[model samples]
Target: MKDRIIDCLAYEGKVSIKCMSSTEIVEEARKIHGLSPTATAALGRLLTITSIMGYELKEKDGNLTNQIKGDGPIGILTAVADSNGNVKGYVGNNTVDIPLKENGKLDVGTAVGKKGMLYIVKDLGIGKPYVGMTPIVSGEIAEDFTNYFATSEQTPTVIALGVLVDKDGVRTAGGYKLSLMPDATEDIISTIEQQISKIEPISKMLDENKTLEEIAKLVTGDENIQVLETINPEFKCNCSREKCEKGLIAVGKTELEAMINEEEKIEIVCNFCNSKHIFTKEDLQNLVDKI
Candidate 1:
């Protein structure tokens, strides 16, 4: 199915929830970055959360960035998203693999490492960007973001991310985030607490062909969940040869001239989507002339 993000309210509209089915987006990342099973899970989870956070921004031009640096084999994980839920990301090492956990699932925590930090930067087309950070509680993306919400943003949130990678590819990948508003009552909160304890992983439910509304009701324990909006999320990169020209010009005329004398051409590859933008000798000389 196509990727989707659903916004909803439950418990008498006192709680906010975001649910995403990111199978297609995650699979695209796996193909772009050539990620292994473990790296696919890590980047997939990070990308989904980044998209949700991006969609939360109010401005059309706003953006959100998340960086997770852990002391594990997967290295650093970076994801960025725009207000329209266009997400893209890359991993430090895309081929990381490890033994499965005792639970017979991918060992995401061990692959991500327990020591590191989660840094989130939100540029909402405002005077200044907002930055929040917190120590990583677990390299598992969900728990780390959960800690970030409580410690950095001071919002109590429950986050669950999961990716099921079979031999064919990412069979399923998705996640959910639920946050309580200040006005939420005790009974509503307790009801959610009870339901979350018994719910399956988000990816598992998606793999079973569960709809976003069904998952929302299942998690919030409120059958009358209010659906607010539906959004399509995808892996997208905004890079072009024109942007590369600006980057080359920023190096100044002298640097551009030197580049022309020393090399046949320069290639700018986007880290997010792996698209190549090559600047030939003629292009370099033209840039120097513009200076």
Candidate 2:
């Protein structure tokens, strides 16, 4: 199935929510990074959450980057998303593994570590983009995001994120975010909390092939939901040879001359995608002349 994100308004506009399914995007990460089940879950949740946040700023042509730095084997996981529903991410330690929790689920908490900081940077193509951060609440992304919403963004939110991976690849990966607007009533907040308390793991819902509408109904009940938009999401890298060349040129003529003297060709590999770019001495000379 194609990956997509859906936006909805609930409780007669008292609350707004976004849900995204990113199985294909997450699968790409799995294949590229060779992630274990726990690592896949960690990276997938970041991608899904970042995608939804990206959609929230669609009008501004902004991009959102979600980063988690922790004291666990994974080290750090970073996901970047654009308004167009494109996402790409990587974890510092893709092969890290830990024992399952007492409930027999992936020990995401332990694998991610209990101590860390979640940093969010938004680039809105304006004077200065905003940045907010909060300490990790549980190392389970949902709770950490919820904490970030409350502390960093000053919005009360409920976030549910999950991913299930196996030996083959990511089987299911997605998340949901429900946020209460400033004008939301106490009754509406209470009702939403009640619903959230009974919510199931998002990965399980996706694994069952639940639609975005169905997931919304599960949280907001059958009554007050207005589906706003649905957008397909994917793993997309914006890196290109031209961009790399621009970066190389920015390194100045001295650096290029040194590189040219030391090696016949300078090979540059993109960290986001594994594509390599090779520049010969002639290429370096051209770049230097252009400067």
Candidate 3:
């Protein structure tokens, strides 16, 4: 299935679940970053969870930025997403590789190193943004994020993120986040916990061709769920040469003059997408004149 996010309510609206099938988007990211198998798993999981969290912002104009810093070979993992589920990000090291776990699973925790912090920044296009942080639990994206929601955000949450990669590329990538609302009862929560234990990994569900609707029903133990919204998620970058030029102009006349005088040309590359923009010395001179 194409990349998409589905929002639904379960247990008669006492709980909320968001499911996503992000294979296409993750595959695109893997190709763009030239990620190795382990790095692909690490970054892909971050992108998937970030997309789900991004869609949670109630405001249409809001955006969320997540940074995962650990003491591992992967370095820092950063991703940004809009309310509509469009996301872009990059890894500090895109070529990290390591041996798999005994279970034949990618050793993301070792690659990510189970130390450091998970920082979240929310920008609603209004007042000052909100920032919250929590320590990484396992350096596994889902576990660390789950710890963030429970400890930092005070929301009881369960998150599952997975990416299956091979020589071809990302074979399967997706995740699901389930949260218990304030009105959720002890019995309902217990039921959900039991169901989660029985359910397969979110990626395996997607690999089985399980639709979001079915996954919602299975998780909530409610055959009748209220489908709130269906949205297509994409791997999109907001960077442009114009934005880079504006940044260059903001560096002040002195810096611009120095760039013009010392360098024949300067190239600015976007962090979100590795798109490069070249500015000739003449271009720098024009900016200095405008200054």
Candidate 4:
């Protein structure tokens, strides 16, 4: 199925939930970065979670950036998502890979390391954006995000994120987050927990072709979930040649002149999409003249 995100409320608005099955979306990330299986899983999971979190910030005024900086070989994985479902991210180490764990599962914890921090920065489109930091709980992502919600946002939340990658590339990537609002009752929380505890891994569910709506039904149960909206999520970058030119101009006419004299062409590569933009000497001269 095409990748999409679903928002819902359960127990008569006592609980807020969001689910995303972003196989195609995450596969695009893997292809863009040429990541190994382990690296694909890590980046895919972070990208999926970041996209869902971005929707949570839409009611506010700005953007959201979620960064995972670990002591493992991967160094850092950073994803930025906007209110409109546009998301982009990159991993500090895209080639890192390790042996699987004893359970034959991707050793995300070992790859990410137990030490480091998960930083979240939210821009409200006004003054300064708010930043929050929380120590990593389990480098496995879902637990780490859960810890972030509990410690940083002070919301009782459960996050299940997963990404499965084969030798070919990412096969499936997606996740679900269930949050208990202040009005949620103890009984409701207990019931949701019971359901989640019995379900399969979120990634496996998606791999089996489970839709976002189906995942929600499994987690929140059939009775309480109220599906609100569904959104198609994809890898989107806001970088282009014109934007690169504008940036060079902002560096001032002196820099442009130096580039024109020293280098035949100025090359700029986007970190998010790896798309390269080249400005020839004539192009540089035109930019300088415009300034």
lDDT of each: 0.92, 0.86, 0.90, 0.86
User: Candidate 1, residues 1-291: lDDT per residue as tens digits?
Assistant: 789999999877799999999999999999999999999999999999999999999699999999998999999999999998899999999999999998899988888899998999999997899988888898988999998888878898999888999999999988899999999888998999999999888888998899999999999999999999999988999888888899999999988888899999998999989999998999899889888
Which is better, 1 or 4, measured by TM-score?
1
Model 3 stretches astray by more than 4 angstroms: none
Mark the 10 consecutive residues where model 1 has the least summed lDDT. Answer: 147-156
> Which window of ten consecutive residues has the lowest lDDT sum in model 3?
216-225
Output the number of the TM-score-best candidate.
1
| Residue ranges of candidate 1 with Cα displaced over 4 Å | none
Q: What is candidate 4's lDDT per residue for 1-291, written digit by digit as tens?
A: 677889998888888889988888788888899887888888888898899988878755567899999889988999988875568898988888899999889888888889999999988788888999998887888899999999878999999999887777777888889989999887888888899889999889987887777888888875657888888867898899999989999999887888888998989999999999999999999999899
Which has the better lDDT: candidate 2, or candidate 4? 4
Look at candidate 3 and tell me the lDDT of residue 177. Answer: 95
Tens digits of per-residue lDDT for model 2, 68-164? 9988888899998888878898888889889888887888888888998999999987768788999998898889999999987899888988888
Instruction: Give one digit per residue, the lDDT tens place, for model 3 in 1-291.
Output: 679899999878899999898999889889899999999899889999989889989789999999999999999999999999999999999999989999999999999998998999999989999999988889988999999999987999989899988789988899889999999999999888888889988788888888989988888777888999999989999988788888998999999988888898999888778898999988888888887
Each model's TM-score, in the order given? 0.98, 0.95, 0.97, 0.95
Q: Per-residue error at 250 for model 2, in Å?
A: 1.0
In candidate 4, what residue range of length 10 has the lowest lDDT sum?
Answer: 54-63
